[model samples]
Target: MRRAAKADDNQPVIVKSFRQLGWTVAHTHMIGRGFPDTVVSKQLPSGLKFTAVIEIKDGAKPKSSQALTPDEVVWREAWQGEYKIINSIEAVLEYHDWVMKKF
Candidate 1:
């Protein structure tokens, strides 16, 4: 039997951070089947909005613990869109800044 999905320890904080930055976040962890944890979208200065799929992993965890599962690998390989595995608030902030600059 498949196990229930659990959010990483830092997931709530990360989702809050994204919201604070004006991004709309949709939690998708319960969707399972290797789907990413969240989908976040923001409107750029150019009036265009873009969305990205994010998989959250706690940075405090060991590297081995943070490794993606086999199902995740398969899903990622088949996905053809903006996707990232993010760990920590700093990384989230940095990514937001990068998006601000790029758009």
Candidate 2:
């Protein structure tokens, strides 16, 4: 379990780590409106841009019931983002590696 207050805290760590690896990343789940959890862009040395939106949740699983919730489902459908449920800072690091590989 985790405090809701810092639930999305993984956003910056992931962003910074990726940036160190030379990825251009932004927090874009907001699409503006202050909702973006993390938006990452990778501009290859070749000038191609790869953009990915990541939503980070700490210490909680995304309940199917919640996903079925009206607004949640809507965002899931429209955002094309990822729901990452992590329990610790280490999880965030590991998950970041996994997601990058996935992309």
Please give the lDDT score at residue 33 for candidate 2.
Answer: 33
Model 1 misplacement above 4 A: none
| Candidate 2 C-alpha lDDT tens digits along 1-103 | 4223232455666556666766666655444332436666665554556666555554444554223335444565676545543334566568656655665
User: Which 10 consecutive positions of candidate 2 have the poorest summed lDDT?
Assistant: 1-10
| lDDT over C-alpha atoms for residue 98 of model 2 | 62
Model 1, range 14-50, lDDT digits (tens) per residue?
9999999999999999999999999999999889898
Candidate 1, run of 10 with poorest lDDT: 94-103
lDDT of 2 at 37: 60
Winning model by TM-score: 1
Segments in model 2 whose C-alpha atoms lie over 4 Å from true places? 1-7, 28-35, 45-47, 59-70, 80-103
